[model samples]
Target: MDLVKFFHMNGGVGDASYLNNSGLQRMGIMKTRRIIEEAISNLCKSNIIKYPKTLVMADLGCSLGPNTLLVGSMVIDEVAKTSQEMGLNPPEVQINLNDLPTNDFNTIFCALHEREKKLNTEKITDVHYSPPSCYFTGVPGSYFGRLFPAESLNFVHSSYSLHWLSQLPKLREINKGNVYLASTTPESVSKAYYEQFQADFLQFLRCRSEEMMVGGRMVLTFAGRTTEDPRGEESYYYLWRPLAMALQEMVSEGLVDEVKLDSFNLPWFTASPTEIMKLVEIEGSFTIDHIEIFDVNWEAWKTKKYDNDNDNDASTDDNGVGHAVAKSVRAGIETLVANHLVKQ
Candidate 1:
């Protein structure tokens, strides 16, 4: 299987959409912004840490642009409000936005331009607003070594990213004969998903541990699964298996080459809150300030009732067949087949 090409197509598509969609961007930004605010609020209340006017914060997998600006603006505003109440000066915020080199830089630059216009109009004379610095970079491989100076950041954030590993597992390692087939069951897929999540997450925390100030905080949010099924029947399988079948059907219809289908697999994985918490426990660098799980409307699959409360009804035709079919297949391929194809 040509893993690089497959990722370039599938993974690239997902990241592009994430950065371009305003609705999706808003949802992610608002959630992370709230967490940052709350964490700062708690720190202030305890008097454990004082709000520095010039705080350094970063969005590790900061896709496009507005989301990064959203975070930066929120941090500036929060510090301003806190300082006013505490009789301290508002701190200047240094926002570092990081993402893969393949991400859309043009769109990000445009978004930053718009944010700059807004900030200029506000003209809050009491404080200085510095243009946020942006870096095009990847994590895991990029972060394991040192990217930032020691004890340089006050907070770090990532969203809907990091579940993606530096590289997908080798196909030969799972099923030597045919790389295209489902080499592992759904349950096995779920377990492997969590295992990778823990490893990558720990690596991330450990790297951040060195960069973050002693009392620095981090908040991350991403897609996750809830079922304990080995085959991942109730949760992601419903979306994936159909896609695999669809690809098989496509091959039979001569719509695409069997070789391409064989090489393709999901590019990302989802984790349950329990699985995520366990990784945090093991890492032991940062305490759980708060963790919340809520339903994410992915515009695919019918919602269903299950033990994990994550099931979706397959009967609903809310989005038409074409979109429904494509979305369902993509979700399955990205989250299920590709991520857990091999055992960790």
Candidate 2:
């Protein structure tokens, strides 16, 4: 697939839009908020600056949605709180929200104004909280390459994004039946996947390293495997396996072409901590400051449940999880798949 043009999250405010299907990612963002806060706090305590005039921060892969601003607000709030506790005036912030060129920046721009108004309205007392002076701008580009001027950024953040490679591997045909790394995929296929991730991730670090000043910090949260095996359960295969199975069933029923199914593979790969650290070490750009790993239940995003409470509970949960995963993946990739099928 053309990763640059095709790999964007579902846009707009429809039911299937990324705004609606991204609860899991939003939950992940909330879970990591403390970690992000700590990173910014530590950066402040490190004598990186004595209340610098401007704090330049960027959220790489910050797709359009409430979560985008939500995280930005958290980062800004933490910076202000930390500065206040340290008896230092908080610096004015330049918040850069970045994503692919095709991303729905319009929605983010509209919401930015709304968020400022809402924050202003919530200020009630003499000692009331006010968000730090901040400027918001849209950066339409890929994070795999340099997106900012050298030594310009003070903090960087990305969540639920780096697992996606800039592009798929060259040996795409090796994993014929699978849409991602699977048990049946050949060793060559797995090796190719690993190589691609390493290349993309190293380039990403190199680019960011150039943009960030000395003592700057970055916090990234994304889907990753605890096991070294690329096909491990924590890998994104949890979602892709069920979706691939459903697509195979469609092929069996003549609803989809088998060739197209075989030719399609997700342009994503999950990295283990070991894999990530190795690339970081090799790149020699930044030190491994901190790393945390955790799991989220597949059905954790569900807002409704079965009424019987015991209606084949295990089976129902499994089906419900699969449906949720399928819907999320569909929202992300439906446009690409539809475009390809139409050309065929």
Candidate 3:
């Protein structure tokens, strides 16, 4: 399937929409907020441009949601706060919220004006309000390639986005009977995934390197494993394993074709920090200023009980896992499923 045509967060404010089921992604943004703040502060303090009159920043893969603006607000707030502390004037913040062309950018634009008003009131002071301001724009494209002009960006951020490959690697014959990496997945399949990640990530860094000014900072936090192996326990088992099982059950019940399941593979890959560092070395564009890891439970966003609360709770199963996982995954990839697997 062509991900560019179909890979989008379930659009609108419907029940299955990304805005409704994106609590896990929101948690990830919150976890990495401090790092983003520190990066912005570093940009402000760095001698590269000495805090230029206009500050340019981009949030890559900023899909439509309330959390989409959360970090944008933080970046603006940090710039204001850091400038005040340093006794320097705040620069006009030009923020570009980027995602795939298929993303729900209209929803984000609709909510943006009100969000700007609220953030300005809360984060900025009246002295520089008339001149030094914050502007928000949407840039729609894949981050795996160049998306901005050369030397235009001062900071870049991407959270929970890099794991998605530009497209599934061309190894369908080797990775059979699974939509993602499984414990039984062949070594050839794993190698294909790793090679794709290396290529994608290297391209990502090269593009950012061209776009960002010297001494610029990019704070990225994505789904990655600590181990060298891509199929390690923390990487896939926590989520995709059970999701694949659910699909397998559907196949057994005759709702889905077994052959289709055998042919379909998700365009997602988790890389180790070592792998990422090696690629950064090869690309040699951005230096690794700092790195950290944090874990969120699979069921971190699930409510204890649903309103129905009957024998079968769609919020959670007997083991208290799949319901939330299913909703979250569906929010992200349901479009692909509808376009390719199901007969629409």
TM-score of each: 0.71, 0.90, 0.89
TM-score of predicted model 3? 0.89
Q: State each model's C-alpha RMSD to the native.
A: 7.6, 4.8, 4.8
Candidate 3: tens digits of C-alpha lDDT, residues 244-272: 77888988898888877787788888887
Candidate structures ordered by TM-score, highest first: 2, 3, 1
- lDDT of model number 1: 0.55
Cα lDDT tens digits, model 2, 191-229, are 888899989999999999899999898989878888999
Q: What lDDT does each candidate get?
A: 0.55, 0.79, 0.79
Across 211-236, the per-residue lDDT of candidate 1 in tens digits comes to: 99877778788666565442344344
lDDT leader: 3
- Residue 11 error, candidate 1, Å: 12
Which stretches in model 1 have alpha-carbon errors above 4 Å? 1-17, 43-53, 122-145, 171-194, 234-245, 298-344
